[model samples]
Target: MATPDFVLDLRAKIGTDPLWLCGVTAVVVKGEQVLMVKRADNGAWTPVTGIVDPGEHPATAAIRETLEEAGIVAQVSRLARVGVTGMVTYDNGDQTQYVDLTWRLEWRSGHPHPADGENTEARWFDARSLPSLSDDMARRVGAALLPHGEAEF
Candidate 1:
């Protein structure tokens, strides 16, 4: 993933100290499959995600990230879930806490591919047979798949 310019500026002042950021995760769905990306940084599979740029709407960021990371144009079908979560320290010592908004998205056009260097692979998985994911990610996806409406926390 390309480090946001804000993150780079912060890192210059604080080195590897933890930073609080806002992000969006897109659960881009087509029929019964969900789009997923295998991250280049750690090879872990997850929904399309990216830091929300300053002043950008979470829904807009979700769609933009889906296109940027997976080569698919999407629209936020619904806001699935929203909450503050995370305090992760990467192997490189960069730490971040992300307040994430996860959205259920509908694919509009284009095939899935790893368009950005951040993702090593991007594909659609049968909703019932998804690959192993971190508990947090599983919960996010599950929230998007819920039979009811949006969730807030």
Candidate 2:
């Protein structure tokens, strides 16, 4: 994943110290299919995810990430989950944790592809037959699949 410029600036001052950041996971659905991407960094298959830019709305971030990472245009249906992630130690020795906002999105246009280099592959899979995902990613998907209502915390 590409680190944002603001994060890079902060890293310059804080070194490897843990930083709290906002992020988004976009679970884009079209009928019974869901969009997923294979990460270029770790090869983990997951819903479209990205760091929220400064001052951007989380819902907008979800939509933006979907297009930037997966070549899919989507609109947020609802915020499905809001939670803090476990500490992540990046390959470059940077440590961080994200307050992740997962949103269920409705696919609007475009075919899925790894539009940005952050992912190796992007495609749709049957909601009931998705590829294996990490527990955290699975939880995000699960939250998005629930009946529309208040976001899970």
Candidate 3:
């Protein structure tokens, strides 16, 4: 007899395996430039993103993280993507398995400064002037920033 795979069953099994946290990132664009940060820990330049608090929604997390990490305020335009990311470990023994809900945010107001305890150097670069980044980071900044991302809110 032939059998079909059950998506819900597979999801349930996967969900039970680890601690998951919600995170957000901004594809913050101002004119022809985008904002990125070099993480103090790893020195990898990435968009401003972080984990959502216990009672916070994904959109709220995105806005809060933008202000916290980059010292800039942004209007969350649309949810670019919602997918689970692999467990990323830090040198400090802090490991996170993330269920990232990233969004396309527009530069609304304020200046850039490194705040909150996450990043060190924050700078604006022309989209083309962006530095080499991991593949996951690159995709989240590229195709995900369009208005077509889910409006799940």
Candidate 4:
């Protein structure tokens, strides 16, 4: 896995965890709704995410994952949030700590469906009607909508 953009930047600032350079997540929002995919792996609702591939840009991977998982295309609107957490990586054998870069994506256009291997179900839900989600996904959504954060590419 490669370090997502914001995570790498955050690691520079925080300076301790060598593993801060790790995965990324995306919180895609549309209208008064947000997009969520039921992950095929865990059978749980989560934000669109993937391990950043080597030599690929984080933003590109985020956009790609959004398309592939949720069957929707969106524009990256902001660096909604960055989280420091533990990840049990597939490429590595440890639950080493990670800095997750979560982007807020604005709807562009696309019909919603489960588009790839990662998702089983993909749909938009009313902001108020959001289903039970992982704590990390829920936290990312809250942070993306907060007034204090700036939209960063």
Candidate 5:
């Protein structure tokens, strides 16, 4: 994934010091299937995820990321989960953490593909038989699968 210009600027100033940022996870559902992406960096199968741009609404970020990363259009159904992630140290040694907003989305249109270089594959999987996901990612999907109501915090 390309680093956002704003983050690059911040990194220039702070080096590897941990920075707090906002992120979004889009768990798009089409009936019993869920959209997923195979990340290029780690080959992890996960729901469409991205950094929320400065000043962008988290729900809108979820929609934008789904289209950009997975070549699928989706509409946010509701906020699913809000949680903070543990610090992440990237390959380049840039350390950061995120307050993630997970959104439950409904498929709108478009075929699934890896539209962006961030992922090597983008496709839908049966929700009951999805590839293994990290515990955190699994939690995001689980939260989204719940009946619509207050977001999990």
Candidate 6:
């Protein structure tokens, strides 16, 4: 995973101290297909995700991430899931937890492509025949398919 510059700066000051951060993921749906990205770091398929920039709304971050990472323009239909989704310790000893705010986004334009180095591949998958996803990804996708409502926590 590419560490954000702000995070790298904090790491320089705090060493391996744990940091809690807000992040956003986009469950981008176009008809029966959902967009997924193959991560450069782990090669696992996941939704377009990124850290919420300081002072940015999670929904805005979700839209930005989807465009930046997968070259897809989308509009948030509703908040899908909001909870702690990533609690990880990197091989370098850096530890972090992400409060993942996921959104159900409707694809508005553009095809899937890896627009950034964070992902190696980006493609749309049949919602019913998706590649293996972590429990967290599965939960978010399920929530996104539900009728619009208040953000889940």
Per-model root-mean-square deviation over C-alphas: 1.3, 0.8, 9.7, 6.5, 0.7, 1.1
Clashing pairs in 4: none
Deviation in Å, model 2, residue 151 alpha carbon: 1.0
Best model number under lDDT = 5
Candidate 6 residue-wise lDDT, 2-118, digit = tens = 778999999999999889999888999999999999999999999898999888888999999999999999999998888895568999999999998889999999989999899
Worst 10 residues of 4 by lDDT: 87-96
- Single out the weakest 10-residue window by summed lDDT for candidate 2: 144-153
Per-residue CA lDDT of model 3 for 1-153, tens digit only, reads: 011134234435664344456677777888778889888767899998776666778788788878878898888778776667898654534355877776888888888877765777888888887899889888788755465745432
Clashes of each: 0, 0, 0, 0, 0, 0
Per-residue lDDT of model 2, residues 1-153, tens digit only: 788999999999999999999999999999999999999999989999999999999999999999999999898899999989999999889999999999999999999999989999999999999999989899999999875889999
TM-score of each: 0.94, 0.98, 0.79, 0.76, 0.98, 0.95
Tell me the spans in candidate 6 whose CA falls farther than 4 Å from its real position: none
| Model 1: lowest-lDDT 10 consecutive positions | 144-153
For all candidates in order, the CA lDDT equals 0.90, 0.94, 0.73, 0.73, 0.94, 0.90
lDDT of 6: 0.90
Evaluated at residue 44, the lDDT of candidate 4 is: 84
Tally clashing residue pairs in candidate 4: 0
Q: Candidate 5 residues 14-128, lDDT tens each?
A: 9999999999999999999999999999999999999999999989999999999988989999999999999999989999999999999999999999998999999999999
Q: Per-residue CA lDDT of candidate 1, range 9-54, in tens?
A: 9899999998999988899999899999999998999999899999
Count of clashes in candidate 2: 0
Score residue 125 of candidate 1 by CA lDDT.
99
